[model samples]
Target: MTAITINFNNVVKLNVDQFYQLCRDNPDVKFERNQLGEIIIMPPTGGETGKCNASMIADFVIWNRQTKLAEVFDSSTCFKLPNGSDRSPDVSWIKLERWNVLKPEQREKFPPIAPDFVLELMSSSDSLSETQAKMQEYVNAGVKLGWLIDRKTRRVEIYRQGQPKEILEFPTSLCGEDILPGFVLDLQIIWN
Candidate 1:
């Protein structure tokens, strides 16, 4: 199933706390909020997508463990962006220094800061346009780098702050660039 967006802007606008509660109340449901306060109900990804996501997350975790420069987060972790949107990238990372600045309590709930890097793996149910828009939102929210990997099309859209997006066709691998510092992702596991 695809995601369904419900606009409650006309009736009742949910504040941050209310949105958090709504998510908490529905543990089984995956929800996201746009900058306009519209609720997006996302469906669970297919097995292939889940496996690909796990592989990508494992790579990030291994790199983070070795470098200890950033904190890695899986898809379940959400971030409250500067533009008031709540987003959860498939795999995300924040510089340790930036993460350490948040109070202990702040770390327990949705993080109120943008991540340094984000990776989004597209699923069959996702819309390319919507996903691209989401990636742009991440850039606007101060994300240093972002990757939108489309398995179906075998393409990757790279987003960098203050620069236009770069699209690559069937890249065998991806570098973390300066933001990740020495990290690289092998796309073989994702592609085949």
Candidate 2:
């Protein structure tokens, strides 16, 4: 689907408060705002996508429960990036210390902190270029690590700060490295 950008030339651009209110008014819609002041309205994920997304995040959830080194967030949690964009990565994690630096109000609202790690699942409706750009944005906003997984191609693009993206084809499992210490994502976990 082609995304529509709100034309600010003829229309008044929404301030952050207005944008937040607009989101609150539309409970059923998923929304995102880029640094360019463009609003992205995303269609709800299909059942298959939702299932796969759940599977993709299960490992992180369990690991966070055990180690509690970081807080894990599902797709529904929105974060305010340092660049002033509101984004929701499919699966996100923030180190415990970083997460606690926010005031209670900040934690309750869209927290103004970039995640340390982010994972994005490419749905059929998603634009691959857009997804890749979003990953780059995460890196630019200080995300230490990010992954863009394309199940159809069975390819994974790993993003690391100050490093070019590393692409892997048909990997068996993913190593979390020092960022996640001892956590591994098994490729086989994705249901057929």
Choose the strongest candidate by lDDT.
Answer: 1
What is the TM-score of each predicted model, taking all chains together?
A: 0.99, 0.95
Alpha-carbon RMSD, each predicted model: 0.5, 1.4
Each model's lDDT comes to 0.96, 0.87
Task: Give the per-residue lDDT of model 1 (tens digit) for 1-192.
Answer: 999999999999999889999999999999999999999998999999999999899999998999999899999998999999999999999999999999998898899999999999999999999999999999999999999999999999999999999999999999999999999999999999
Q: Can you tell me which runs of candidate 2 are displaced by over 4 Å? A: 1-4
User: Which ten-residue region of model 2 has the weakest summed lDDT?
Assistant: 1-10
Residue by residue across 1-192, what tens digits does model 2's lDDT show?
Answer: 544446462577887778788888998888888988788887777787788889878889998899989999999888889998899999999999999999998888788999999999888788889899999999999999998988888899999999999999988888888888898998776536
Off by over 4 Å in 1: none
Using TM-score, give the best candidate's number.
1
Worst 10 residues of 1 by lDDT: 102-111
